[model samples]
Target: MVAFASLKCIIISSLLLPSEAFAPQSNLVNKKVSESSTSLAGVGKVVNRVKDSLLSKERSREDLKIGIAGFYDRSSQIWEEVWGEHMHHGYYVPEDRTDHVQAQIDLIDEVLKWAGVPEPTGDNKDELPKKCVDVGCGIGGSSRHIAKKYGCTANGITLSPYQAGRGNELAKEQGVDDLCSFQVADALEQPFEDNTFDLIWSLESGEHMPDKEKFVNELFRVATPGGRIIIVTWCHRDLEEGEEGLTKKEEKLLAKINRAYYLPRWCSVDDYVRILKENGAVDIKREDWSYIIAPFWKAVIKSSLNLKSLVGLLKSGFSTQRGAYAMFLMLRGFNKGLIKFGLITCTKPKE
Candidate 1:
């Protein structure tokens, strides 16, 4: 939990954007998002009931979707409420921020290595829009990194207005504000010309998208010929030979994950790769990285349970109880082999 005073200090000192820029209405969901406010309202209503069913202190998968969604919706509020305490809102934080930053660079290096793009030259270090977009650019952390490292401007698109404003502020603080810009827009209906970006980065955000095909196709459409797209996402492992698939208990757990974390479904990596290939993305390489994620969350749970964390949660009004439940689901999903981590790198033909 993060104290309100701390949050206020962080927001006030770090964010100096114009009111229009930070306002909720300024950011908009991606294109093709349903405009049915009533639908959202209704979902919000049932979200609670579903959550209660899922987190009843007993294992059950019936109504898992509702349970999962409820957990997520609750968790989202808590994350936002205590944004100052958890950098990047509980996304994995590398032990060192600089190391985390460099890892992203290495990820990009891997992508460019595969895409066959020539290394940059000294003469053209500062370039604009030479073709990179970070989908789900939460808080613009990665966008700022890319801008600083490559001297190229990258458009970051996200649905959360709060994240966009804060991300821009961080950009300014880091002196990369000029090169990186964040908009409250949906990645699905990205507002860019077709065949525009040389690289499309979708990092751990695919699970939130309901229409996986459309999501990948949008990436394909925006990417130039010979361009590359790198996607890292959370997935559910493939069904085993004689096991019941996605028991009600599991569905509820996943739904809790979705609701709390804003994911739609934890689809399989095979499904994701197939979607990319179906949409004309070629030479797809897919790998399951669940081995890394499960243990990662286990450590987070331990850290969160520390004495300082307990004290912080009690002092802050934010619901750390809900946060613990979410972590539990995440850990359990990972341990049971129901959850998976996946990465895919694909390229569009130059011709």
Candidate 2:
């Protein structure tokens, strides 16, 4: 029955939805409603209920929460050191650098390009910003890039106040301060007027949202008529329910990821697209970049083992146990084929 439902849901979702399925609402109260609506809508309601009954009790484990916090705390320290910013995933290093570090940064640049962010110029606002919002703007690397490359004003928001502060500092240093600003804001309840941003860029942040539809809808609402939203996120494979619960391997993998990485939940690329379309986005385009992004987690695991980095991490007062937990989760997620790295772009219609 579970497998049949998973397959059925996949077919319905894939055939219809866009990517903004995880997007949120206008303010605080309605935010919850939007979230509930998106999750409970159509097939999602069934999936959510089943998942909750099976996993909700374990979802709030203290040890898991602590581990995730440590994971963020440790990684943020390393990011600040490397890029003079607080980005969690990777950085944009120019193509001309001579070192291994520079080469890796170049790879990040490629990902950004692949993700559709144009190369940064000294003057960005003129090119990129008809209106823009950078979701989860860790350390402001990409946000600054958006402002500099497009020469348009941008509002970069993050759940982590630390990330926002660091992003603002870097933006100021890079002289894109006037065009780019950072705010400590929830992606689920963005603090912007409707129809404000022309471009919304969410880099690997959608996984953290518990109520997926609200998050996507909020992005849609802020987008000016005919504006665009781009999402590059970590996701899980489409489920195929069988005799037991949710493929034991897959369930374990998702639980591990959620426990270690602070992600509220993970969903399939097809489901993501469905929610977006249902929420009113049109002409959605999606591409799975899992093959290219698969190695990023490998690199993260490697970085977690650096002795010098470990020393800093220790001094930073984070838990090595939690770091281990996160790495282990990443490994499990990859091995089980439960996580996917994907990209989506869509345009809101002009009213």
Candidate 3:
């Protein structure tokens, strides 16, 4: 039964995965491999069969940017048409019926509120940041939101040229182009002057970074002293005291996910806290929002089931299709407690 379950997980997993836009991303591939994560791992030959079936390939570090850029470039417009901007997970609570697109918007506001991004002045008079940077910025959704909300200039970066161009075009149409700018750039080596941005926001993009510490270091380097940085991302669960790395089962699950999503080795929120501290960041805080975002993948799965989603996906090409089917693994990982929707916030100490 364990082998059967493991086979099921890998088969579904080996199939491919998605954006937090998860829904309308545009659909889960086939349901044959749809067993839970608890049923995955320790099934060797079946893993090979599933991998072969999916034709999943491991990308090198050199190819990470290319792979990620390709995935988004092919999939972003399809998702924008189907899911409506905000290509990240939605915030949800039991019995709450907010529309999914709005829920995605709510996540940005919720994360900033939790981070005390503006430091809560109680009079809506908190010092608005003069300049902000959205690292791993996808399609300029959050950038435009921040720019429009605070009247601040917001700059965004992405590896996908399509995203950079489309995001800029969308901002122009939305009348926020003057306040929002986007470029194709690497997050590990950011392209801004030092002591620049006062607020750094990275939503969901940290999952794609190959170097966690370098990502943090870059954020710190670009930030003004006293700047606030918030990273809301996907992370593996923290290791318990006395444990080493993730258990073999967890590794298997995440490995399949890595192949699907072009992710590098994952770290925990605890690891992030350590990195922030090492970088001399102050006021560190972290939280796990697994429960609150539980509805996200389910919503995505539902959205991807329709005809329009399918037609759009078919045209988006192979990797996007693989990503579409692999989304169930995201749910299975969450259900099994191997994956976490993590939030971490810290401030560069004023010097």
Q: What is the C-alpha lDDT of each candidate?
A: 0.56, 0.57, 0.73
Tell me model 3's lDDT, rounded to 2 decimals. Answer: 0.73
TM per prediction: 0.67, 0.69, 0.83
Clashes (candidate 3): 11
**Candidate 2 local lDDT, 124-143, one digit each (tens):** 63444466788867667677
The candidate that wins on TM-score is 3
Question: The CA-based lDDT of model 2 is what?
Answer: 0.57
User: Cα deviation in Å at residue 345, candidate 3?
Assistant: 0.2
**RMSD to truth, every model:** 13.3, 15.8, 8.1
Can you tell me which runs of candidate 3 are displaced by over 4 Å?
Answer: 1-50, 53-58, 119-126, 307-316
Ranking by lDDT: 3, 2, 1
lDDT of 3 by residue, 201-257 (tens): 998888888889999999999999999999988889999999989988888777777
**Index of the highest-lDDT prediction:** 3
Please provide the root mean square deviation of candidate 3 (C-alpha atoms, Å). 8.1
Where's the lowest-lDDT run of ten residues in candidate 3? 1-10
Error of 2 at 339 (Å): 1.0
